[model samples]
Target: MSIKGLAAKIFAKRIRKRIDTWANNPIKTQQKVFKDLLHTARDTAFGKDHCFKDIKNHKDFVKQVPIRDYEQLRPYVDRVVDGEPDILWPGKPLYFAKTSGTTSGVKYIPLTKASMPTHIKAARNAILCYIAESGKTAFVDGKMIFLQGSPELIEKNGVHVGRLSGIVAHYVPKYLQKNRMPSFETNSIDDWEKKVDAIVEETVDEDMTIISGIPPWVQMYFEKLQHKTGKQIGKLFKNFELFIYGGVNFEPYRVTFEKLIGRKVAGIELYPASEGFFAFQDKQNEKGMLLQLDSGMFYEFVKADTFFDEHPKRLTISDVEVGVNYVMLISSNAGLWAYNIGDTVQFTNTDPYRVVVSGRIKHFISAFGEHVIGKEVEQALKEGAEATGAMIKEFTVAPQINPEASELPYHEWFIEFQEEPLHIENLALQIDNSLRKQNSYYDDLIVGHILRTLKITTVPANGFNEYMKSVGKLGGQNKLPRLSNDRKIADVLTAMTTT
Candidate 1:
């Protein structure tokens, strides 16, 4: 057997035992994580400030360390950036990941020596668990292309700082390093268009067996390859068997992926962000991703509806219910104390907890008092795309609330398509129906005639791409916000596309 296949067999055995052990009693695993942190950093400033030394359980931990977002925790992070040791964790962090988000221009999230394992080990186990469940290890012996950013990092104070993907890419296994592409030189190209051209040139004829990246960027790479090779991706790399994606939900882009790959490949979903690698698709039969219970982080959830309340009730793993949208909070080894990451999620399965990312808490629209979230808009778009044989390249939704423009406020969806629908009106109907089914408030608004039916604006192809380029965010890691509560992004896009 090949070295990777042999390694996969051994790793799979370890992961299988862990899966059942952690699943059977998640509360025990969660409690263990909480206790471990309290024990290790009881002497640190944040530890003493939060009374970690006296905290006996999760309830006490919650009472002492109030929930906060990144902005609220900026003072503590500033200390870390200024070279303070034992601020959030014991000693200093190993690095900081520079994240570009919608609300914030830049967010520098710490990555401690302790928290680094949470990223690496979970990624390894995600693959090992897949191998255990599927028994498909042949691809392990072949090459896998992880499309990521440049590994070169900048020194900030005493710590290295760079994009999360770039930092992680530097740690590719030696065995896989032989096959990973494009080269560091190619990846370092700052311009997205130039970087993409380089990636296509490097991997067009390679024996690629697996590909991992954010879906939109990967789709761009595949299309470029097809155009250059004068053949489909399947023809260029017949051995390609796995499609690993995260950052953006894969549902809306599913049909586009099929067209690019030109064949079926196993899809593995991961919920990874600058803060932590939170979950992974554990079973092919399972509906949602399995949460990482013992990954050096304690998890909490505040119901999304009440997330903006004066005093929101935070629920631990033991209390979170299935089917409720929540804004997640984490107390991790990176020195963050009960920090809210802004993204929202819903528990699809409670036992052996599994979750689906609902949407960004700040990225929702309630212009007409019908709070429409990211997940609802994407689901509506997905259903619409599938029903009308439309393939979406990119999309965004914004609230149109101008009093002069109409009698009532409604949603305006700006979509760029890979394949245009036979009739866009049919696509609109499918989207409206899906939204009404998912959110009753939205349905009631339609019924009460408080808002008119939704309007779909189909932009010319590459319209969204040009906008991203103009903003210097045209790349794989960056994505267009699918929903916005305000018209900031929508107005800019509408103006650009109309011109």
Candidate 2:
């Protein structure tokens, strides 16, 4: 092995041992993080307002700090943005992770010096863990591309502001800098389409081994490569071994990706957000990402079903059980206290605290009380595709309460197919059956004559991409919702079908 590969193997072993220490002592590690976060921020304005001085335990914390989303915490965040010191964390944050919000317009998430390094470390550890478990360090010498936002940052109130991915781009380790692809000039392009084209031109002939991004954008990159070279991605880049993705489930995209690549490759799922780098896939054979119990963040879980209740019970890692969906609340060194990050997760393994990002708390179809979630829909589509040999490019689900022919109301699924099934009706039926099995309420609705089985609305090739483009969210950390309660997206997709 080369010097780089040999070094990676040694480093990977150390990281694996460290991971084991924390993973085995989940509760103790979390308690330490919880104590450290409170103690560090005890003198901040928010700490004083919430009586952090008197808080001694999780019970005291629950009494002192109420759960707050970004909107609810904006009063404090606004002051921080206006250059207020000690408003949330100790002093001002080093940077603000700017992200788009549906109701709140723009959100500036604080990234303190203490918190920023955790993000970098967690991401680095994820790769090291992979190397240790897989025993594959040869890729360390090859070129890798991270499809992400521009690294350019705008300064505001003495704090740099940009997308989280862009901010992370600045922290690439010096050793790997030589192997990272896409020149800085190409990555800084404002337009995603143009940026992607530039990236293709820069790295198409390089020794690319690893690709990382959200699924949609990575799919776009793969498609661009195929269009340019007229070769399957696996053939075009024989060493493209590992796909690292976050922000969405990869199950529904599996068949399409396999078809596009012409072979199966290993993948690593990451559960990261503006709030924190929460979890990462550690083992090659494991089902879920290992939760970061010692990453300077304390976690609380509220049953997602009862999250909005007047007194939803908040449970820690010790109280969590497998297979139950929970809305994760976090108190981190970055100055967020009891903050609801809006994503729901389910523990797949509780012994070492591993979890899968199930769905967003808001991204579901509950128009008729059936309350279908993103996980169910993705799994259903996966099941249907497997049974009927269908390859889907993308899909979304929304309720259709009214029908043009005065038929019974049903859920409308807009699907973009890479390869159509022999019978579209069979695919729909299979998916509906799978969903019915997963959600009892949906089954009851269908049997009680209140609603019919789901109906498929086939979207043309590249239709979803066009929809995202129309909204100016075609790429770069943007993701299409897998489920919506309303017809906003469905209506636009319906119009495309007619035109």
Candidate 3:
């Protein structure tokens, strides 16, 4: 190995040691560290000189610190953008990570110097944990490709600034940054399409090993790469090892990716948003573990069912139960307190705090009294695909409301099959049966024949891509909506469904 490679290995070893020490330490000690961090964050958000003095008493601290959300912090975020010192923190923030928010078109989440360590440490620990679980020391040291949004940071003078990815690019070990692929630094998200096209054109012949990004965007990149090269990406990139994905589920797209890549790529779940890196896939790769940044913010979980209800059960990190679905509520250093971000997840095990993302709270289907989650839909689809000897490249489940009667609601399955299955009808029946078996409410509703019908819409070879592109989302991270409960979904199905 070269001198640089040896040094890289040594550095990785030291980082790994730090992570192991942190992970093995007692939970109580960790919790105390986390609590102290949260208090510090609170002081920074509220005026430090004034707030810091009053926060010495625990009861007084909790009472004085008001719950906050993005809307509440918009003014502070604006101030950060204006380069005002000592607003949220002592110094100017490094840069803002732009994230998609519900009301705000794009929310620029501030990351102060004090808080950047949490993000970096969480990300590093995630990787180290994965290495520890796998018992693999050497990952193929090749180019690491992060399939991300345009790194361009918006400037104060109305001119766009540096790409946040590029800013992160600088922080990465200098050697790795030097060897990393060039980032797309366009001003508009719309321009990303052409930029991605350009990347595909230039990198067709290059060897890429580690790939990271949202699965939908990665899938889109691979599809384009295949189209341009006229050969599967597996043949083009010989040394590809790890596949890191975040922002969505990877189970749905696994088969397609495995086939295209010709290797079983390790899936690393990253829990990063514009806010900061919250958690990441554990070393075991079985589930994602929350990198408890107790210091960064206090964490809370609300039962998924409580979202629409007036009084919902909210659990602190100490109160979380294994296997129960909950929506994450974060009180972060960036000024979000008791905030609901909408994504739903469940803990598989709590000893080490491993969890799997279940679905989005808003994405659940409630038709004929049967509440079906995205995971259940995915499970049914997987079973159906297995039984019918069919490969489902992409799919969606939408409810169809009867025009004559507002009370009547049925389901329509939109599928993109890899090959024409011999018995498509049988496949649809199997999917419906699986759904009925998995969810008792669905079974009861179907038995009553209230939501009786299951209509299948088989699309052309590359129909899913066309659909995603039409919606202005063409990539690995953007999934075809698996469960659409919205009433307009029925109209969309009516127009699109052929049989």
Candidate 4:
């Protein structure tokens, strides 16, 4: 074997050894994380303000610090951005990751020098974990095409502001730079359509074995490749063997991706956002990603139902229960103190502590007594696709409740299909049946006639993409809401069928 191949095997084995060690005793590993975080930032202003030196245990630490969201912490971040030293963490942050999340138009999240390890190191380990679990590393010798946003950054108050993936791209290792495709010129283009075209032109003949990105963007890249070369992606890239995706659940798009690739390839899921890298698929047999305890970030969970209450119950790793939804909170090295990142997760495993992201805390369909989540919608769509032999490209669900009417509300599903099903009504029926089987509350509501059965709206092939593009949210980790609590987005989509 080649020297490089031998080194790759050695690296994978080492990462697997570490994974096994940490997974053996999760609670102890978590406690060590908390203690280390306390000592690391004890001299910072935030630590001094919260009395971190005197707060010895979890209970005291919780009592000393209050939970906050991005808006609540904005003033302090603004001060740090304007050349203030040691306002939150030690000195200033490395850069700010800019995003347009639900509650705000543009939010700037800090990335400290201490927190940089969480972004890059955890990302590296996620790939290594997949390799260790799947036992496939031949792809390492070939190129990887990461369908990401522009790496160019804009200076905001003397600090760089751009997408987190873009920032990471700018700092890629020198050796791997040779095997990464889409030259700096193509990657630096700001337009998504033009940039994708440039990427296809640049990597059409390269030895690509891995392609990683959010699914929708990667699907678009695949379509572009087919259009240019008049060949299936499998034919065009014979060495392709691995797929990495995240930012949204992959279950709904699983069949579409398989069909596009013309075969099944090993896939890995990541749980990452601008706040922190939370988890990644660690074992091939398990569905949930192992909760990362020894990472630089410390985690806490507040029951989602009581997240907004005056006295919400905050639970540590020891208290978190399986199957219960909890809003995630963290005190990371990124100067965040019990900050609520707005995501809600449900624990699926407790021994080693694994979790699956259920949905956003503010984004849910609880307008009626029945509370449906993202997992239910994605799973139902997968079942619907199977029953009807359709390929759903994109979808969003919203409640159609009319205040003027005396009747109950019903759900409206807007779907974009790659291959149109023979019976659209049957597809809708299958999806409704699948959702009822999964959610007891929803089933009870349907049985009681409180809410009518769901209604499907067949949209143009690229309808969802067009809507996202119209709103200027076409790419890079921005997902169209699958389930909205109200009819505002539903109404907009209904009107788009006419346009």
Q: Count the backbone clashes (under 3 Å) in each candidate.
A: 0, 0, 18, 0
- Candidate ordering by TM-score (highest first): 2, 1, 4, 3
lDDT of 3: 0.66
Task: Write out the backbone clash pairs for model 1.
Answer: none
Per-residue alpha-carbon lDDT of candidate 3 for residues 160-197, written as tens digits (9 for 90 to 100): 34434444544665656644564434213445567667
> Model 1 off-target regions past 4 Å?
403-407
Poorly placed runs, candidate 4 (over 4 Å): 403-408
Taken over the whole model, the C-alpha lDDT of each candidate is: 0.86, 0.93, 0.66, 0.85
Least lDDT summed over 10 consecutive residues: which range in candidate 2? 198-207
Better of 1 and 4 by lDDT: 1
Give Cα distance to truth, residue 146, candidate 1, Å: 1.3
264-377 per-residue lDDT for model 1 (tens digits) = 889889999889999999887898999998888889999999988988998899998998899999988877788899889999998779999989998888988899998998
What is the TM-score of candidate 3?
0.84
All candidates: TM-score: 0.97, 0.99, 0.84, 0.96
What's model 3's lDDT at 323?
78
Cα error of candidate 2 at position 269, Å: 0.9
lDDT of 2 by residue, 1-499 (tens): 9999999999999989999998999888999998888888999999999898899999999999999999999999999999999989999999999998877999999999989999999988989999998899888889999998889999998999999999999999999899997878888998899999888888778888999999888988999999999999999888988999998999898888888889988888888888899999998898999999988899999999999899899999999999999999999989999999989999999988999999999999998899999999999999999999999889999999998796889999999998999999999999999999999999999999999999999999989999999988888998999999999999999999999
RMSD per candidate (Å) reads 1.4, 0.9, 3.9, 1.7
